[model samples]
Target chain A: MRIQSLCAALAILALAGCAADPAPTEQFRLTEQALEQAKAVGATDDVPELKLAEQKFTRAQGSMADQSFKNARMRAEQAELDARLAEARVLTQKSQEQLTALDARIIRLRKQLGEVQ
Target chain B: MSVFKKLGGGLLVLGCAGLFGCASQGSESALQQANSSFQSVKDDSNVLRNAPRDVIRAGESLARADRLSNYWGSGADVRHYAYLSQRYSEIAREHSNEAMNQERLAKLELERQRLQLALREAKLLSVQQQGKWLEEQIVSLATTETDRGLVMTLGDVLFDTGEADLKSSANRTVLKLVQFLQLNPKRVVRIEGYTDSTGARQDNLQLSRARAQAVADVLIDLGIDEKRIQVEGYGDEYPVEANASERGRAKNRRVEIVFSDEKGRLGAAR
Candidate 1:
């Protein structure tokens, strides 16, 4: 009876093994990475009005870190919006950077042609 | 040493052959299960061909559900038979269900057509002979009973914001409702009040009950027998719309007519 019970216990463990899922750390990491990518653009026009949304998001996050899930969820939503804004800002900055690089390259080519002439 | 080695080699060959035979037999059984289930699905579809359109559609849905249910496998050869059978059974079951739905839909269509025809005839008879909106109002949302009575809805438009004060606009609505009730005096009147989820749950319930009693009070004033009226409050629990949006909340805050002798039984759609 003891041996049979051991075999049954092993079988149950095998079946239950499939349910032992890890925490969704990967999703959080992806969200964080996306957020950082969005911030690298630094294209905020820096008007006083632009600071309002950022302030709200900061407050929400502070409340969330205090172990308040309700406030955390609300802050996370705002954070997503902020991240989107950051993404747009970064995209504009990158585009401007690219244009500046192209202008420099064109100036260099023109100087080379003048020398050749 | 040579004789011992020969005997061992022969035994190993026999064991390998036996293992191979078992594998082949397992595969054959799996194939049989898969094929039988496939045939079942085919037969189910054949039934669908003659089924009405609704039945056919439901059967199609069932078939897809079956595929989803059974297609997930243990991902092993030994489990191949079970997986195949599951997949095939799902397919077959869905097809059969759809076929049945098609037939049922056809019958519903017939019933609807018959009802419509009857409605037209009733309307014509009342207009040509009696000259009125036929007292026999056929509405879909109300509950049906052996008795035909007038059904009316008086909304929060009659009340103040968050308060159950009977407003002035409520007069016209109440008057109209009163006339309907007077016309069908023997019928029962069920007054139900509902609220949006803006307030505390306890407050909402009290408000609903208050509003319901208010309506009942008005009907009683209009000469409807107090004993004939059944007043109840469902509150925000049975909202007709989602409480998230403003417009939805606006719709949620109201009193609705549930049972009309003419329309049958109507309530917040569950």
Candidate 2:
């Protein structure tokens, strides 16, 4: 009966994890994949963030795969949030990209104009 | 044309919709007050057009959140993210509009100066005794020359090399024009940006816009009415000379400042 109670407790914990709302599994996968890609881009300063996201997600996926569904679900939720923070860094990088590109264009144009003039 | 308008309309609509979605939530969310740092930052941006220095700093801080939009989109704590995103938009619009207003006022001053100069030019050049003949001559000469209508000239230094900005001397250049317009209070200023043939068309368009905006910002900073300024970008489409020459390209990378006689005040917050 004591063992049964422990099992019941674990099951309830698992349900709580799974029931956490407002995001989808697909979104989780995207974050995971994006984190992986970010890792491959070695120069990216957000690698630490991606790594954190990756670690959380991997743990979450592991628990779910092992049928510790509640634990897995909780980890998954945490992982999703981590991935989003990392994604924000990615967006900031993208915004800076425009400024960089603009600078480059000006250089090239001025060079070309100098050559012609 | 309608299709282009529809697409642009769609983006503006989406932006506004996105803005309001968070606004309604922010109204109800204790999160606004819960995060004092972010909340102070969010609240501080609201002020007279020349927002306090601290307020400007707060607005700049929200722009730093551009990186967090991905997580911001997720369903987890969405209300919080939405509120932050809306705040970012508000800050950008607020500062940009304020800057824009300053540009218009400066341009008006420039026009006033130009009028006085034109009068002097007319007095010297006009054979007639009346100032009317001088005005006629000034008007005639201005219209005949397409490139001379207050547009930045070829070889005119708009910016320092390797920069996406106006030169430091741009302040004086803009101020001189502002002083010109201050002498004549009845003109509207039009700011147009253009680029030479050396860059990709799309980028050139943007470059032109930045150049124009740089001038306009200076004008607004000089106390030009924001409402009286009209900013547009023409990119490389109307190059005055062949891009095949350096001089021509130099001329192309320019901004035009035109004065309008319309008496309507600009920017009553439409």
Candidate 3:
């Protein structure tokens, strides 16, 4: 009975060890890179997605400090996506502004053409 | 003791089911939302064409989320993947929009170039149609081929008294000048302004400069390159006539356009 109880205890310990996640160092690096790329593309805190990314990234860092590898990985992964979305949003807005300016120029050109005719 | 143990095991199983039930409910909704987002982006041909990789990633993430939702105690992972999938779909849509806009911008740019060319040609033709008569008038008015090169004088009558504004009567002459410069693209011009000795010297200087600038502004508006024109204010100096008589002062109050040679060799400014 003593041997059986010891075996059960060892099995539970192995299971617990298996449940614990590995430190997500690579994921953290990827998150940081994504955040930097978003900022480079003119994503400011005014952008909601960028704000979310910053908040989550900070929380992910806190989780890392606490050794909650699962939480840290999840938050960092989400943060990366948020930052990417922010960057994409900023690019889309810039392209839209360009379109508006182009449209205005075309309209002005047409008006000039009309006057000339 | 055995019956009590059986009751305890049953209660434990019930409690575990309750926890998983709540978790699965939330995870199920999140998965559904992500699936919807992915489906929309996947259906969009433009999104597929422009952001195929992102759309594929979104679908893959959504599938992972769906698979995770079937397991107990994996609710957080399911939600995280679902969120990622949704974000990817949104990013894909935005990228496709940007691509479409860029394509439209290119087409519009081409159209704009074509329209610009048409406008320029129309202007040149209109100017040429009125060219013959205006050319004669300009030759008669441009009386002097002085040492300062071909000098054409625009008299004080072209401006309102004490005002720097050119009268509408000067429009034909200005348009003709614009046409002449366009025809001789290489030729440059220096517009010099003079005022009568009636005003204060300082005032005369400012007025002369302003008048010259006014003519230059019109030339620029009519499409002459600003670099091709130089403006100067002679004030009461270098008078074509004496300041003693009103007719002489009127003659002195003038703007003279000095043209460069065919090779754009402009004479030195006086």
Candidate 4:
């Protein structure tokens, strides 16, 4: 009976371990999708946060492959947030560039009108 | 068998305790604060409208944080997601603020351009009005625009026959001409005198020259710059009509004052 209880306990612990550390596939996929979205917004070229997010996402994939689910999840969450930040930064930069171009156009028009030298 | 049972019970107890430990989530207040901050930002109309993508990203992060806390009891990771959610929401709000500022600047620039155009139009209109006033003054002088500029005829009635001095009655017309000339100092004047065909050529030439010089002297006395006046005598040449008629001879014995171009340069007689 004692041998039977030990075997049962070992089986339960093994099952719990398997359930608890499921590969973090969903988190990895979500982070990759977020990175793609950032790239779509030109974040990859214009925003440093995007590159950092990519690095973190790659590290998260490595952790997931190593069966470090908790670390992988944490890094994936971080990567997702970084990608969002990058998207926001790229949008702000684009708006600022448009405003700058408009200002230059206004100055040129003002000069043409002889309002400015 | 008894040792095995005891080992299994101990392991079960330890596992239960560990499960309880994981269940006891920390950073609950942190997650709550982040949610509250995000809610406030999302409530802003500008952020909701202008930064929709950023707002959606923030919502997703907040949802992830909620899931991590409720399903896994991961305190530190939940707090991180919450923080990111709050940060992203704030970024959206910041983007809204910048967009609004840029829009306002664009509107102000457009208004500035409009006002400048209006001012330029007003200036041009004022110059045109001044030109109209000058045209009216020229009409009162009986002057006509010509290739040379404005030409005003001083009939021979202003001087006695065979005389070089101007009649005192001509003062009023001379004064008006003087005012017009003073108003347009950049314009020069040329005075030309002619005679009828009755006089000898030499005497007529000398008399015409004298009459032209006398008229020029009057203009100088009236404050016109002496350097801007030129005097000439045509001596019965370039008649206005046939000198055989008395009325035509009266017209021929007259002085004509020609105004110069805008640069004060007078054209030669045609």
Q: Using DockQ, give the best candidate's number.
A: 3
Tell me which of candidates 1 and 4 scores higher on DockQ.
4
**B1-270 per-residue lDDT for model 3 (tens digits):** 667556755655675577587667777888899999999999999999999999999999999998888776577778899999999999999889989988998998998899889999998887666564555667787647889888899999999988999999999899989988887788899999999899799999999999999999999999999999999998888987889999999999999999898789999998
Interface RMSD of each: 33.0, 19.9, 3.3, 5.7
TM-score for chain B of each model, two decimals? 0.43, 0.42, 0.51, 0.51
Q: Taking the tens digit of each residue's C-alpha lDDT, what string does model 2 give over A1-117?
A: 455445446656754755654344664576566566555444254445666767877887777667665556556655554554455445445545544555565555555444433
lDDT of 1 by residue, B1-270 (tens): 667556755655575566456555544455456555555554655534532342333334334434433322222333333332433344335334444555555565565556556556665554444312223332222323333333444555668888887887777667756665565555566777889999799999899888989888888988988876777788798776898998888878887554444333433332
lDDT minimum window of 10 residues, candidate 4 chain B: B18-27
B1-270 per-residue lDDT for model 4 (tens digits) = 778677877877776566546545555776787788788878888889888877887888888888877743366667788877877886788678667767876786786678578667866666556655765776666677777677888889999999999999889788877776776668888998999988799899888889989999999987888999999998988898899999999999988889887678888965
- Select the stronger candidate by lDDT from 1 and 4: 4
Give the clashing pairs for model 4.
Answer: none
Candidate 3 lDDT tens digits, A4-41: 44645665685587459899999999999999999999
**Residue lDDT tens for model 2, B128-237:** 33333433444453322333233333134858642447777666556656655564456667777878877688988887777777778878888987776778778788
lDDT of 4 at B64: 83
TM-score of each: 0.31, 0.30, 0.64, 0.48
Better of 2 and 3 by TM-score: 3
| All candidates: DockQ | 0.01, 0.04, 0.41, 0.12
If you assessed candidate 1 against the hidden native complex, which CAPRI class would it receive? incorrect
Q: A44-117 in candidate 4: lDDT tens per residue? A: 64477788788888898888888788778878878887887787677777777777776786666666556422
How should the candidates be ordered by DockQ, best one leading?
A: 3, 4, 2, 1
RMSD, each candidate, Å?
A: 34.5, 30.7, 10.3, 11.6
